[model samples]
Target chain A: MKKLTKDDLQAIKQEELKKETANWIKVGLSTCGIAAGAQDIYDFLVEEVKKRNLGVSIQRCGCAGMCYAEPLIEVKVEGMPKVFYGKVNKETAMKIVEKHIGGKILVNDHIYDIRSSQ
Target chain B: MQQKRILIKDTDLKKDRTRDFYTAFLTEIQDKKLEEKVQLVRVSDIGIYGKGLTVRVLPENFLYCDVETGDISRIVSESVVEGRPIEALLHKPDDKQLRLVLRNCGLVDPESIDDYIKHDGYQAIATILEKMTPEKVIEEMKISELRGRGGAGFPTWLKWKLTRAVEADQKYVICNGDEGDPGAYMDRSVLEGDPHSVIEGMMIAAYVIGATKGFFYIRAEYPLAIERVNRAVTQAHEYGLLGENILGSSFKLDIEIRLGAGAFVCGEETALISSVEGKRGYPRPRPPYPSVKGLWGKPTVINNVETLANIPLIMLKGGKWFSSIGTEKSKGSKVFALTGKVKNSGLIEVPMGTTLKEIVFEIGGGGIAGKKVKAVQTGGPSGGVIPEDFINAPVGYESLQKLGSIMGSGGMIVMNEDDCMVDIAKFYLRFCVDESCGKCAPCRIGGTQLLHLLEKISEGKGEIEDLDRLRRISRAMQKAALCGLGQTAPNPVLSTLRYFEDEYKAHIVEKKCPAGRCAGLFHFSIIEEKCKRCGLCFRNCPVQAVSGNRDQGYLIFEEKCINCGRCFEVCKFEAVSRG
Candidate 1:
């Protein structure tokens, strides 16, 4: 890789943040998340997404501070609002992939928070 | 699709019907003939506590507290439809938490170098390496007025200046990441969340102090943080930021990771340095401080993880800007791990001078299960307990210190009425005793004696004279101990005794644990009047302590009862009495 000039660094940053990608899922991958079996959930989601040929992009991030409720998975579909699901296991991860991602319906009881575009 | 939002909360604290709150909300929303347009959603947590009914409207984000059936129309019509706030019932809650150290935590990918650069990460290092002189950097730090976050409130700039003044061919900068305070993980979170920012901070420190070698002293408990930091350092080296000349500058620095063996005492500077040198982790007397003689007899500058995290921001935003955020002496925000009986127990960063009330109620969403807050324990095991009466005191270094607590690594544990002061002190002292290196006399011997006395008092076997004995020993340990481990270990016991001596008196004179925490002081009995012959308690009890049939009703055999409180916990009806 070439040495990044000031403008090059600025452009790279802008480009990374520029894309307004819809339909994405982020799983907490911190120590808390790992303890709560987030790695299993992450692997299950990745495998299911590939098998089903889903368009949603799966990503990994750090802890969102709510550690008591870990294996925390956040799902956001194109037109649907973003929701954080707490205490998520493999079953819930599959349910999220099937319902929240494939279908537009939201599963109850596991939802922690819901946020709109505003 | 029409942008309708409703927040539901169980306002009645006298009884718990939090589960039934959703049904009531659904019924109310359906009565308005607007159930289709408005989606009735159940939130796992609503950031408000103790209020009866809390309803919020989306997009506008207008909140109404203590909402009733009569006011539901006004909420649905004016706020939801018209997008206007209700003036009378509006809750103007002040959020105390200011997020300084944890500004980017959970928001950024820690392992990615590009992601770190995206948030103006390396700009500080570039600015420092290109233009600023070592003296100027140290001057800026002095102007910033940042006290050490690793307790004691030592001026960070003065530490750097002293190290810079020491003449040595080779110097070192070490980031102290060996955080071992109970209920405190603020450092771990920052390192795991934003690894590059701290690396950049350390790099800046290296440049300013003219040190070519730096060490990241992290505890073994945080494996993930170590992994991410190791990856970040390797990437920095690959990009010519760590090894040799970086960004066409002649200054060169190399960083290494040193794992601590998970000893609480190793957090002390002397002990930490000793541990890094592959020697015993016991602290020696500090006449020639680490700034003068450190790491292989060379001058070294050691800074806490949270302290180093602030350096990048200080450089990016001018030091003056960084200095202006806090109070007169203490500057910038503090990241507190708000745990133990807090509603939303998570990481909160509030600016200095923000009150404990605001942190406990506004940002932390009040006490756990809407129970009244009894006391807040700050600064971890080495810190003291601040009672509910002084919740209004602003959280600056001097203010907390005045309340008999030092801001030690920001572990803020909120306690409810269920917590006993004596029990709390005993817990902390027990923790110190367990982690004590046993190298020195005051810590090794005094700590064990204190724990034994506390245990005896809790078990209904103590005299009033023990209180005077506790004070005497605590003083001796504080003044004569070899390191901070012994010096501050008695803080919790001393502070609790000073503030809540009446509780200790009750333990000693009345032979009662007021909070029902001590097993010896409490008794388990099956209330014959309340028992409905369900026999659930008898079946659930680990020990078959409950006797008698439905005809005679249930009676607890006190001798057989181990008092695990399993009978109290499993009984659906309030049939078991514990005193």
Candidate 2:
């Protein structure tokens, strides 16, 4: 990549803003999250999303401050309310991709927090 | 028609009626024929604790707490359908945490610079380079009243102004990432989670101080933090943000990473400067402070990781906006590693002046296992303990200091009734003694003496006169110690004695450990009546202290017992008793 100028920085930010609003899954992959088996969860989610040919983008992020509820995943499906699923194992990750992403209904007993779109 | 969502959770841990409420809400929605229009989600955590039956109606984001099953139909019709909030049921949460420093923590990808820029990162530095001068930058910081988050609470602008005023051919700025507090990892989190924000903050600081070069003094223990920061620096360099002529301007700045050797004393500014210079990490006296003579005897400004992280935001939004959130003296939010006996042990960022009660009970979800909280230990080894009686006091630089504690870093360890005061004091004093760099006699000798007296007290061998000796040694260390390590090491001991003196007296006079923490003062015995002959104590005892058969019942061999309390913890029938 070439060195960015002032205008290039703004252009990149604006371009990324448009991409950020699409359907995406963010897994907490910080030290705290990784210690709680988030790496296996991330890998499992990535494989499942590819196996099912789901268009939802899977990404890695950092800790969300909720250390107690580790292995956290935040799912934002278009036209559905964005929610955080915590204490997630492989079983819960499959349910998130199938139920929340595929079937459009939230998985029971796993949703920790909901971010209301305002 | 836009679909409306209703999120429900029972915040009361004592009893969970969330499933029952979910069924009731489903029935009400089905009866009204609005099941297609409304989606009900039974969440595990609603971010509000201790309140019964929390219901949040999305799109409108109406939160109702302590809700009963009877209020379901009214909530469905009035709030869900009508998009109106009921005034009586509406829960307006006060003392809510404000996240400025951690705005992008869990939200953005740490490795992606585009993700950071999308969240309006580096915009402050760009604007600063284009418009503001060094004096103007310092003026803005002065208005914000942003202080050092590394413990001392020094004004950020004053440090910059002093460094800028010095006439030096080359100046330096260092980001102190050597956070060695026992329970604190706030800096590490910021570095790992949002590395770019800290980088931008460093750029803003470098611009203000007119420093061409800067260094990140991160401890080698945080390998992940180092990796992320390293990647962020490389990324910035590629984007023309780190090396020559940043953002089409002549303001060139380069940042390098220097790993600390995990010495607690290296966190002190003078020792940190020494460590970075390829010399022994020993602190020299102040007066020709770091701003005047730092980093190879040149003008240098060293800011904490959290303090530097606040700069970009403070510049982006005006200083008045940043200053409006916190108390009169200490402005802006503070990130605390809330650990220990709290129900929710996590990282929380709250505005300054939020009371300890609010932090512990409200945000932390109170003490673990429904136990009553005993006290809170703030600022790690160099800080003191605040008893439960003063939990209502607002947290500020002066407020915490007035309560015999300093807001050192942001390590808030919530201690419960099960934790012994004598043991807590001993733990912190021992940490200081172990970390005391033996360059100064006052710290080296005084710290060891204090630890010895604490050990004697915990072992039930302490005399009443030993209390006076502890005080005397602590005072001598405070007066004669070279650096912050030894001077503030006695805070934990002094604060505990000030608040829980009765517990200390009990250990001395009655030969009892009130909290049952001092193993030497307490003994484990099997209660014959309460014993079910389960043989759990006999099986679980590491030293084979309990000897008996299942049918015949058990007896504790006091001679064999090492007072490890393994048998006491294994007995489910309340058979094993300790006193």
Candidate 3:
């Protein structure tokens, strides 16, 4: 790879930001989240989304500071509000993929927080 | 029209009324034929505590606290249907948390360089290299009033300026990642969460001090932090951010990582400098401080992990903007590892002057299991306790020092009523005694002596004269010890004695442990009236101390009883009492 100039740094940032906004799922994969089985949730969601041919991206990030609710997954669908589901298991992950992604209806009793884009 | 989301949660811990409220709201949505347009979700946590019922309408982000079933139709009509919020039930949340150091913690991917750059990561260093001079960077830092977050609260600009002013052939910069405070892991979290930001901060510091070499002295225990930082270093080197002639300028820096062998005293600056120079980790006397003579007799500026993480942000936004966020003396936000006896045991960032009450009750969701909070222990072994009465005190460096506790790496352990003050003092003192390097005579002897006195008091063998002895030794240790470890070792004992001396007197004079934490001073007995004769105490006792049958009442023999409190835990009925 070639060394980045000052112009290259600015260009990369702008190009990445301007890319198409797709439906995505971000699982917190920090130590706290990993200790609570976030890796399994991330793997399962990736496999399920692929098998079902869903147009959703699975990404990994660090701890969101709500450690009481670990293994957290933040889902952002196109027409619905973005939300975080905590203490997520395989059953809840499947429900999220089927209901929230496929059916556009949110899964109840599992939502921890809703991020309002102000 | 976009789908309007209604999120509801019953914040009351005693009884959950979310089902009733959800059902009522669903019926209203169905009545208006807005089931598809409006989705009702029964959430687990609404980020508010103790409020009766919290309902938030999304798309508008209108929050209503203490909502009732009777107000459901009005909420559906006014807020949901007409897109307006009611004045009376509208709850404006006062969020006390400000995220400056932790801006990219959970938002950006730690392992991905593009994700970090997309969030404006290396822009600070680029701006510094292209436009600003070394003196200009220090000027901005001085205006920001950003202190060292490594527990000493020293001004960051002065440390850099002092190192810059020195005329040395070779200068160095070290990022102190060896955080050894017992319950504090704020450094570890920041390292693992945002490795590139810390690297960028280090680059900015090195450029200002005119140093081309930097070292990250992290502890050996944090394996993930080490891995991520190593990757980040390689990534920066690959992108021409670490090697010579960075960003098409004359600036050149090479960064390396050094692992500490898990010595608590290595968190001290002098010992850290010694360890980095491939010697035994022991602190020496200061006059030619680290700023003048450090790391092979060259001027070195060592900054904490959290302090370095704040530099890039301070440069991106002007220093005056950073100074406007916090108190007069201390600027910017602080990240705290809030743990122990709190409902939400996690990492929280709050402004410098936010009170303990706001952090504990509003942000922490109060004490666990409805137990009333007794006190809070800050700064680990080197700090003191703040009692419940002073929970309203703000959390600046000087303010915390005035309350007899230093803000040592932001480890705020919330203790409840069951935590005995004497036990708390002993626990911290014992930690210091074990971690003491034994290089100096005063710290080695003074720490051991102070722990013995605390042990004697907890065992109900202390006299009034011993209290005077504790105060005397603590003063001597503060004045005579070599480094910060031994000097501040007596803070926990002195602060506990300051606030909870009455409890200590009860342990000494009355020969009873009020909180029942000290084992031998208290005993367990069964109340005959409340006992169901289930024999659980007899069955659960490890030593077979309780001797009786179901027909006869169970009696605990005083001699064989070890004061283990197993019977107290095993009792299904509230028959077992301790006194």
Candidate 4:
């Protein structure tokens, strides 16, 4: 591999980021998030996504700075609004997949954040 | 497709008229019959403060401040419904938070070494090893004026310089991840969110101080942080960044992970060193500072996790650029774990001298459940509470210390009106007492004694002379304690007494806790007029203390009442009252 310049590095980062769009499920994998049962949620989401063969790209990220409402799952799908569901356990993870992914409907009570596209 | 989206926020912190604005906007949309075209929604938070009625239009990102009901039509016509900014109401130039230490946090995949490399992470170490000398690295640090974020604000360059000056065949650099400050999780976030940044910093420190070995003394409580760090270290070793010839250079440094048993005093430098050396975690004296004679009688440089995370960026960008962001004395951004009764309880990184009010009310979205903010406690057990009046005080090392608090590891806990001053003091004092290593008499005995006095006051058995006893013992601890642990342990108590002495006097003289927090000082009673002859209070009392029929109404029995406030919580009619 050749040593890359700063511009090349930035370009690669941009290209990689471009791949992350449309339907995606991001689990908060940081310490605070994990302590609040994020790992179980992450595993459940992965298993559910695999079992159903859902068109969602399941990924992991660090905390979004809300520890009080951990086990956070951020879902973003094209046409629909981007939403963050907090206090998501295994049951909620399955609901996220069933309702949000399969049914194409947003789940209630668990949605702590909503980012609608106009 | 719709090209415009408007975000409306009532910027007045005094009162939330956002609902009024929301109603008016909805009515205007309905009146104009533009419901299908334009969408209006109520938001939880908008990042502006004290400027009445703020509206931000998306796609164009045009901000309109100080908007009124009358201006809503123009905003609807020009900006929202039409897609152009009302020039008169437009507010431009929003300066955002510049993140340095937390740059990669929440951005990169922590488990991936390739992801870290893709961000130009360890390139700083490679560059340093190839081009820069140890002297030049230290000189760059001095130019940056980088201080320890772990508290005390000691110059980072000086610590490295002192360790570098020592003629030793073996030297050590330790990353102090033993973060036990109440409400503080900045270090844990950094360690778990972006483990590579800290590892990169440790590598730079090793290259500068010529240390062959490094250790991360993280608390055992943060299992995920430990797991991430362990994974990161193993990844770094595999990448040739650790072990022999790191980054394909002659510099060889091996890093290890050590879990602290979660003793608060172990965060202190001397005690941390002792704990790492397999001895009882206790603080010894200074002057033979860790930089000079540390870690098994070898010169050592221990940097906080956040402090180490800043090193890569400082080295990459010129020192002058890094120093220019913060205040005159305090340079660079500080990551504060903003907790307590704030609406948004999490990590916030603001520049130095950014006022406490802005961090609390603005960034943290004010007090929890829209309660009036009373005070903010910083530095955890070693810090003092700043009253609402001093909310405008800038957040820095000197400013916080001058206001009877030290900037101890950036734990900013916002307290609302419901928190009693005396009770708050007692809470922190008791934390220090529980965490005290019991090695020194002043710390062990004085902290215990002060905690006892505070307990007595909160329990309604205190006298005025107890105040004098607290002061005398605080002075003794401040003067005679072995290290930072004992020396600063009495801060929360002393600072609270200094500011809210009247609250203490009230507890002792009037037998009342003004905040209704102290259990012994507070009395729970059922107001007869407010009681609706409901048995809710009677059924809800854990001890069955509220004894009376629904016809006569429930009354709290003074002898049997535990002051648990269960009845108060259960009563929906506001029948139960505490005073």
The fnat of each candidate, in order, is 0.35, 0.76, 0.69, 0.34
TM-score of decoy 2: 0.96
Please give, for residues B31-112, the per-residue lDDT of candidate 2 as tens digits.
Answer: 9999888888877787789888888888888899999999999998888888889999999866468888888899989999
DockQ of every candidate structure: 0.45, 0.69, 0.68, 0.31
- For candidate 4, the C-alpha RMSD (Å) to the true structure equals 3.8
Ranking by lDDT: 3, 2, 4, 1
User: What is candidate 2's CA lDDT for residue B373?
Assistant: 95
> How is the predicted docking of candidate 3 categorized under the CAPRI scheme?
medium
The numbered model that scores best in DockQ is: 2
Q: How accurate is candidate 3 locally (lDDT)?
A: 0.91
Which runs of model 3 end up more than 4 angstroms from their true locations?
A: B31-33, B535-566
Worst 10 residues of 3 chain B by lDDT: B13-22
Chain B alone vs. reference chain B, TM-score for every model: 0.93, 0.96, 0.97, 0.94
Listed per model in order, the count of residue pairs whose N, CA or C atoms clash below 3 Å is: 4, 0, 0, 0
Provide C-alpha RMSD values for all models, in order. 3.0, 1.9, 1.8, 3.8
lDDT value, candidate 2, whole model: 0.90
Better structure of 3 and 4 per TM-score: 3
TM-score of each: 0.92, 0.96, 0.97, 0.89
Model 1, global lDDT: 0.83
Residue-level error in angstroms, candidate 4, position B192: 0.8
lDDT tens readout by residue for model 4, B42-72 = 4434566667887776656677889888988
The Cα local distance difference test for each model comes to 0.83, 0.90, 0.91, 0.84
lDDT per residue for candidate 3 within A1-118, as digits (tens), equals: 6767778899889987886366889998888888899999999999999999898989888888888899898999887778899889999999999999998888998888888532
Q: Which tens-of-lDDT digit does each residue in B290-330 have in candidate 1? A: 89998888999899999999988888887898889989988
Clashing pairs in 1: B11-B52, B98-B349, B98-B350, B99-B349
